[model samples]
Target: MLQIESTFDVQGDFGDSGLGKLLDMFRDMSDHDEDPGRFVVEKVIEKIPAPLRWAAEPFEAVLGAEVNDQLDALVPGAGDEIQAIAGALSDRARKFAIRSVLDVGLDAKGRKTGTHRIETIIQVFKEARLELPATELGDKLAPATRIPITLGAGEFEISEHRLKFPAGTMLSRALPRLVIPGVLGKVIESAALIARWFACADTAAKVAEKLDDPRAGAIAMTACASASKSISDQIEERLAKIDEEGRLRLEGSADEEGEGTYPAGGWRGAFRIDKEVEASIDPQRNTFSTQEQMATQ
Candidate 1:
């Protein structure tokens, strides 16, 4: 068996980059209160790299006007229902801020030991709920039913690191079957509803596989939208900082290691891909893979 270990540091801005442009457009829409309609989102979609287009295309369907039009025809006030869900989610997301901590314990031998655990904590000072109209789904669901948006603080540990596999490898296997948390899960439920409305049974089924029960309304989703913008801004800011020289060190065995630096070539310069890892291992087998990102503006 060949044991491999690596460490890398890379930083760069989206300067005139497609991703930067995409993030900027989203930020502008959220900041300026402009509607992120299908047409505008399509323009944003164009800014996504070719490799990411497929993953992003589904969202277009999820957020597009055509889908809303379709849903309104099927569920009458479905559009309002979605909006209410999104708003409810946004309220929940806003109620708690994410805090992270790194707890490290050293062994007496002075060798790095202990869990070296890092965790992201969502601390909720108070729990809150948003009410949604149940008549949209039918009388069985409660209209006055308060969907819990924020809950007791939960801690998620960041212990495992994944190596960057090729773009589609991980996503293709994970997305269709992945079950996500309540925040986005509610949105997925709405998406599944929309997909079924279009008679896109396959899309609906796939979306259904990712759904969580008892959806949160628009307010919760609104918070997710806000969080999405925050995430976009953070990514853009980090990418913008990649300058001059970037470094990578790879160790294939206890005795063998390679270290190198590549010029970020400044912004918008052609990026060079220095390495590629090909493994034929089964997708079910968990393994670690790491790759450095090099991008041109």
Candidate 2:
């Protein structure tokens, strides 16, 4: 058998040319703030190449109007100084905003994870290998199988004898079936409750299949807004109970320390409280609760 091992590098590349342009625009705006007609504004306008100038004209007009409106609302006086600052900053901000939307990893930290680095190296190796010339060894090995084998860049036909395999050799086939663990089964059941609020069909059935439960189809059909509400209430109750238990533990610890010797702030007081507050207001947290309820239902 001819083996063609290959690797693909996935780390990508560095450089934020788009972001750099944005920073430059911001700098120019700052520099032109004092004198509205500074060299920076003209330099910025001039920086736009002739080919892009026509397309950018409409954007420039819109940006100017937006700057004027914003400055009028923000600053008391719509003076030349304000206009200059606004114009320069607005232009840069618009460009940067557009760039940000287009650019992935714009705010990613410099740290390269092992997975990313490994993928990048693999891709580089693959590119390097593809540059190598094809060998005659690959051509010679193509004709000995039952399946017709095409070898070399040019398409050439091979007979069935070229692809023959020994009888009774096991042919591995992948089984396509849902394999839900106990924990994930519960999660799917809970998510079904949330899915009900969105009028999702087959939520119960999907959950049942995931859990390998007999009543999955029936339960999925019965999932509704009321079921979602019940799940939400259950989650809230559990969280409250957990909170009360934690508080009791803290109070007990404080009592043991005698008067005026309570621990000011530990894990619960600091991180836990903040986390609870954040969770209470977070939309994602509510969604998670809904999902959990559906999965467990």
Candidate 3:
């Protein structure tokens, strides 16, 4: 019940291991010629409780069949389209980029819990700039034509990551639609699934010691939502309205001042993870601060 309300945005490449591993899992399920159903139930759904294991049956049923082609089209080539859309949104937000890869290690016996690890890096630039055209005054005075502005550049490392998906809800809502047939159906299904995953994913990170402004948190969250929406748009324009079509809502369970948690609160729109200052930055009390940073502050 860590309810710190915020928007989360990710824009960048999914390292070879992040989304690639997920795709590999899907591909494995599809390519297991001998016993694809067993593979899904065993490798993929093994972590699910016994009673709930049946919940994922639909996913198992559809593997290694005609759906393979549709799945291929849906998740083509290490998610290039997804990265492109995220990058565009990141550029639009003027925020840092995120490079991540998630790896889940299933138990060999298919009866034990697995390990889920997410490695993420935040690529921050010291400043952002916009060039201006030379004017008569500038030509005469030799004034600078480009303006450098602060863009909240700071290094952050996600020391740990956690995923909290409602298995029942995901399976029930998305798996049913998987049988709709055609690539569009697969896209729609995948879109819903991805959106939910974004909403459910959480991270624990260390940031620059000076990064204490709540606006950074809000901006990050908003950017993350926009990034997720961009992915939805890539899948299908109409569904870009994910908030409405996908029932996407971000809720938080924290108390006033954004410092409390509610464990029993079933659904959370925002989660606040404990953070530590990984590094310290001295801006020289505005001496080294850019005009943009001063204004934002």
Candidate 4:
């Protein structure tokens, strides 16, 4: 529980950073006919600690692709520049930004809310008992707009963080049962449908799983298709397809010349599983022999 107050120098250090890039981008956009939006400006202003000097001890890429999209939308054509600026950020500065981003507090203006939603890294460091360098040099430079700088969580360490994969295990159990009938029936009814399911792995990679190796991915997918074939189709039989109206009809045709014949224009499948069920534990269970019971006695 510590609070320190000092004017944050926005233009000097960040003149070559994303802050600079953003200003330059806006100027460029202004030069054109683009008005990005007042809402976007407010959003950025609310989140980033403008012109703050936060240092990362060693350069690292912590921002994910999600941030990349945000950056691109806010300041187009600044990817390389932002990367370069981030690479050049001091270790302490990087630590500052990350800490700020990790903290939970209102913005200096209280416009945005969430951890890392407001404030700069160094401001965060000062709260963590970090001794900050004097801003005498920046004091000499022309002051850019002053956005209030507040810091967040005073300290954090995520180096040992983990991602436990409950998802893969959950799906392995659930998917086999949930998808068996639809997938296997489609594969059997149209063998061509198997290719779609194989391709579906690629779709899932695009939307669900992150695939690292294409060859291994192919092997895994092939294995999945193979496993599905083993558990579902090997023990099951063709069932009548539900009609467009959602009715179940008999799949077999009767002879037209006899009473069993179907009409000439009618369509029907060749096979269907008899679905009458007679399940009971007493009926299906094996009875013990009298000698076995006597021996146990």
Candidate 5:
């Protein structure tokens, strides 16, 4: 009897076919029409606002139309009025945002959602100037002894008395899916659903305050609560639909009996594919790097 063992490292190359498939898949996942990241980015970009615009908002909350007129810039009562309203909405906005975020919806276990909502609030506070109080969260923020904590972004001061407050809008604007990278792609997908909710409460507050009706605040609160629930439900549904579509990308529809494997469908409709893989591990590069490159070559 003779025993023989044979082994060969074929290291087959995909030539052009594999590269073509990969490119097709990449294109499919990135297509604005089909991509959740694109969907979310566009939506988020709409809400992020410009940095200068963001900076102006707090001032508006403080001064309203008082700051509107150039001539009124030095009005006798201007500083007093600004001081009155500057921190007025900060606490209220924080409360409204925190409440709205907690309403994101429940998980499968019938428990409340994760900390993303709180984190969003924290991020908003950190990046933007809010009237700092002696409270715990307030203490975490960069102090603004005067008004404008930053004159403008990257230096270039405007006025000595204007305060040097900076804005987080630039950061918000920076997150849109102009290019769409890894897990951030997943975040972008949920941006529209979550982002608007972040500010809707603040908006409702602003509108109520502007109306100057004693009952308007209560009325808006009720209406906003109702509306927020509906929006949360909508977001939950949209995420579910995306997950179903994304499933096809991650591991293909399971067998009818849910046993055997089927052909892969790459990451077509999936935006959160990274969620399935470990952090620092990109599913695209791992799957297509060596094998697909060799085949494409």
Candidate 6:
């Protein structure tokens, strides 16, 4: 299984009280269309103290406006106040950001369903900002427990558990058909290779500048040589197979003279009867066969 982990702190004055409110609000809103007021309520809930919830209600009303202004200042042409609120919440509360785990599973039809595990630690800091007490924010995240969550086409269950302090709590779920492991690995490998290529190129340029030698560029150039050759060989091999298939199709045609003739060259002399034979024969049968094989595999 592939695991992705990210950490962020929540910002603003509300703290854990605010975070809990926001999570509850989000859980409720997830089923409906976007609402800026609901989003603001969530953010405000993260910043204020529990005892101050009554005092914070009024501020929550203006949250949509405040969040909009912040977003407009940061991103031009950014519309949709609710979306802006969500984005700002994500940015300001990096510390409060939920750590989500998505478990991917595959079905017989090759479709993917994802189960999600979301968790975060809510901490209360001293007034001096020197130290704080950490606690699991909402629900405990457990490894094996599956919650009743409905993902698009696939059905999945999620279970959450709280962990002992000093040990971060974990929320995990079993998701079905989120993605094929093989495809995901290939994407990750491709991205890593691209990043490596760029790093090698940058290093080569730096070395060239320091050495003042034209040959220094070859250091980075050499790293890419093998990758380029591998890609080229794969393309050439595919093309060769395609060409052979085309030739075989042409050979199978009933008219001997018509076979292997260019479509543009007419059937007589420069327009020979054979040359005029249409080469636009549909390859749907072969294409469909190939597709079926791939799907089965």
Most accurate candidate by TM-score: 1
- Whole-model lDDT, model 1: 0.28
lDDT tens digits, residue span 1-297, model 6 = 222232223233322332323323323423333343334334333433343434444444444345344434544323243343234333332222223344434445545433334344332211112122123323332332222222222212222222111111110010011112433323223422122112335434443444465664464345334443443354334323322221101111111122221111111101011112212222222110000111111
Superposition error at 17 for model 6 (Å) = 24
- How does model 2 fare in lDDT? 0.24
Better of 4 and 5 by lDDT: 5
Stretches of candidate 2 above 4 Å error? 1-16, 40-292
Model 4 Cα lDDT, one tens digit per residue, 1-297:
111121111112223332233224324322311122222222222232322102210111221233334445544543333333223222212222101112222445553222211122132211233322323212321122222222223321111111111111211122122122333434324422223222325322321223233443444444435543543332222111111111111111112222221122111211111222111111111111111110110
Which regions in candidate 1 have their CA more than 4 angstroms from the true location? Answer: 1-69, 80-101, 110-114, 121-187, 190-297
The true-structure Cα RMSD of candidate 1 reads: 21.8
Q: Give the candidates in order of TM-score, highest first.
A: 1, 5, 6, 3, 2, 4
Candidate 2: clashing residue pairs, number: 33
Best by lDDT: 6
Residues 150-210 of candidate 1 have per-residue lDDT tens digits of 1112311122222211111111121222223433344344322122223233323322333
**Candidate 1, residue 117: CA error in Å?**
2.0
- How high is the lDDT of residue 150 in model 5? 15
Q: lDDT per residue, candidate 2, 41-99, as tens digits?
A: 13222344454333333343333344334334443344243333334332322210000
lDDT of 5 by residue, 75-146 (tens): 443223222222221222212111101111234654322111111221232234432222333323223222
Candidate 3 structure quality by residue, lDDT tens digits, 226-270: 545554444343222221122112221211221221111112222
User: Which 10-residue window in model 3 sums to the lowest lDDT?
Assistant: 285-294
Q: Which stretches in model 6 have alpha-carbon errors above 4 Å?
A: 1-38, 79-297
